[model samples]
Target: MADDPFALFDAWFAEAKAAEPNDAEAMALATASADGFPSVRMVLLKGHGPDGFDFYTNAQSSKGRDLAENAHAALLFHWKSLRRQVRVEGFVILLPDEVADAYFATRGRDSQIGAWASDQSRPLDDRDLFERRFEEMKRRFEGQEVPRPPYWRGYRVVPAGIEFWTDRAHRLHERRLFTQTDSGWTEGLLYP
Candidate 1:
């Protein structure tokens, strides 16, 4: 096994991309509100490295609101096909507007329009109402490139700790934990 957690993660992620039949980049993001209420949701992992893991969403959405209230989160990546899982705990950092704008520009036209139409994490009385808004947004941005909404934002979770787990016979799992220290990362093991 690689001594560095990031390197090990990179290798495992590569294998997952090839073996996982579905969205290999998907991950579960766990966050809490100011009042300490916790919530978890699936989000696509846009980027990752030693710096942190990156994802994007509407700033006014449920997870976004939670992040605003409490800038800490956990991420879980389960590559079932590979019998591996990784957990990350960290502080969230808001990415610049430029990053969100650049990513938004690359999205499909309908998705861009939907971003403007949907009031995510908010109550919707009727499906037709949202459909009308989608049409309205489409018409509003007709004959021009759709722009990124101000509420659409990107974030990174700067990891404080990371754990890598692999399955073993009889539930004797192999677990490796890496904790960020003042100088650098301290690698350790956990009974599993």
Candidate 2:
């Protein structure tokens, strides 16, 4: 049994990156509204460590609003080729503006513009209108570095529990769960 979930995650993620043909960093993020209604969507993992898993998004988006109202969330990474998955449950924390700014700077110019153009999770009456907005943003930032929108933000999830699952022969499997405590972390296993 590994003592550190983060270290185990690093190892498994590295293997997934090598084996998975597509985005190994992709994870399903589940967030709840103030009333505890849940929603889930796929998001790319921008960073991770003992601190937590990081991802960036538009703060006005549904997920953002949900996070604001309910700080708790869950993340799941499934690597089909590797036959492994990691589940993370934690409380969300807002990343510093500087962190968001730096990551925004690293984004491709088009994506940076899209972040500004898209009013995510909002009703869109027409697709062409969005295209026009995208073009308009491109011209608006022409010859200048596109800045992060006020609603664009970064978040980190400080994990409380992490479960590692692996496929095995037949229907049996392996399950290792690590739970956080005031002193540190406790590791245990579950029936496959």
Candidate 3:
């Protein structure tokens, strides 16, 4: 298997999916506001490449706006089944328009419509109102392809540092980290 940090990410992800019983693709995403207040939530991991780790959401959403103002973010993947975890922190960049468009177009129709219907992170008066809007969108776009809304797109985290951890008895686990620097990737072992 590839040992490059990015390639290792793929390998671990695949292993997690096979071992995890549920929501294997979900990752804890952490982003901060300009004032340094932090927010964390689970979001689906959509894409990964040499460029970075990608996920999609409305740009106007709270997390989205926070990232827009502060271009750094972190991601954590914990697989209880495998007793392993990976943590990443890095600079974020917006995915190119074409890449976002392609991924959006591939989503199921209902999912695409849900993305348009949701005014994410905004106030919701009640469940009825929210579902009404969703139903309305479903009805209006029935049998037609749902177009990706302008507000929705993708962001990729270009990792500056990544760490992998494996659990062991007595908590004396293994920890290894890779950090990008002017000289290229620098690796080190961390005491648990």
- Say which candidate scores most in lDDT: 2
lDDT digits (tens) for residues 1-192 of candidate 1: 348888888999999999999999999999999999999999999988999999999999999999999999999999999999999999999988998899899899999999999999999999999999999998999999999999999999999999999999999999999999999999889999
Model 2 local distance difference test score: 0.97
Per-residue lDDT of 67-132 in model 2, one digit per residue for the tens?
999999999999999899999999999999999999999999999999999999999999999999
TM-score of 3: 0.95
When sorted by TM-score, best at the front, the candidate numbers are 2, 1, 3
Using alpha carbons, what is the TM-score of model 2? 0.98
Evaluated at residue 167, the lDDT of candidate 2 is: 96
How badly does each model clash, as a count of residue pairs? 0, 0, 0
- TM per candidate comes to 0.97, 0.98, 0.95
Top of the candidates by TM-score: 2
For 42-99, candidate 3 gives per-residue lDDT tens digits of 9988988776789999999999999989999999989999999999899999988888
RMSD of 3: 1.7
Q: How many angstroms is residue 171 displaced in model 2 relative to the true structure, after the best TM-score fit?
A: 2.0
For residue 65, model 3's alpha carbon misses the true position, in angstroms, by: 0.9
Q: When superposed on Cα atoms, how far off is each prediction in RMSD?
A: 1.1, 0.8, 1.7
Question: Is candidate 2 or 3 superior in TM-score?
Answer: 2
lDDT ranking, best first: 2, 1, 3
lDDT at position 17, candidate 3: 95
Ranked by lDDT, the better of candidates 2 and 3 is 2
